[model samples]
Target: MIGVMREGGLLVLTLQRPDKANALSKAMLSDLLAALDDPPQVLILTGEGRVFSAGADLEEAKAGLATDPIWDQLSNRIATLPSLTIAALNGTLAGGAMGMALACDLRLAVPGAKFFYPVMRLGYLPQPADPARLVALIGPARAKLILMAGAKIEAEEALAWGLIDRIVVPEDLLTTARALGADVLAAIPGHASAIKRLIG
Candidate 1:
């Protein structure tokens, strides 16, 4: 499930499935990809409760992986967003969830959130785009440790590795993300758009 709210020029998309750690379902992924097509000038993605995402719901993914194209399309939509996109990692991120976070242009993690890319352990391969993004954020060596060794890194380590842009207390997470979004919004619209295009 995804929750959407527009604040000024930004669109906030909150993953709403705490009991399941916001594991993405095929329909959910379809909706998310559609939302990305005409999103607000900035998009902020976060999750409910104490986890950004636990990745794809394994059972659900196993059932549809061969029949559905949701994952590929959703990944493409996220990677090609023309405007700003921020992943607010409110908590732990695992598996496919790591791919989702990496898709964003920026990331803000709560002080204790953990991150990992565990596709190797799952006997699956990440979408090709993800590896490049991971390498871009943290050099190839660190990316190899995460992908090959299936290592999990906490927020502080993620920040040091350049995987996350900032770390904030749990209670201050949303406030800090909003503040950063507002700061970006403060720029003239055309200039902000130009900068986003150049950086993206």
Candidate 2:
């Protein structure tokens, strides 16, 4: 359920299960995690449908996937990646998938995309490292609004709250992501990594 395309040092990973709203299955999560093993200089993650992810696959969630350690593992890997990671959100981001998107260095979403975690309503805890990252991006109160209060924030509110960096038209999403990464992709050997390290 992941499609990988690599060009030079740029890597793009797309969630491919559109019919399922890109709901992640165990195998799909594994594939996505595996894709990050050999870190690229610039990484962009986007989805192939109207929803980036509806979180865990329904059947898999019923089988305890909601609390799986792999979710934390995957998000952590993205969080610690030396390369610049961008979540080029093709659509709405929901549930557990919020971890991966929040972990990215920057987020660019389509105009109509919505952001919500809904874990409070679902009766499940978020991945271990997710809350801090979310809080860092949007502040504790705003993070609680989405996580504890189950607020469904749309693109504008998300941008203003700092949950997402920018909103781009669907057609320009990938183009904008690539443009944002151009400097990193063309940087001297360690320049991008050095800047990322300095930021943290």
Best by lDDT: 2
lDDT of 2 by residue, 83-172 (tens): 999999999999999999988999999989999888899899988899999989889998899889999999999999898999999999
Q: Candidate 1 at residue 176, lDDT? A: 77
Against the true structure, whose TM-score is highest? 2
Alpha-carbon RMSD of each model? 1.8, 0.7
List runs of model 1 lying over 4 Å from the truth.
66-69
Positional deviation of residue 84's Cα in model 1 after best superposition, in angstroms: 1.8
Supply the global lDDT for candidate 2.
Answer: 0.93
Q: Write down the lDDT of every candidate, Cα atoms only.
A: 0.80, 0.93
What tens-digit string does per-residue lDDT give for candidate 1 at 140-184? 999998989999998889999999999988888878777777766
Report the number of clashing residue pairs per model.
0, 0
Model 2 residue 189 CA deviation (Å) reads: 1.3
lDDT of 2 at 14: 98
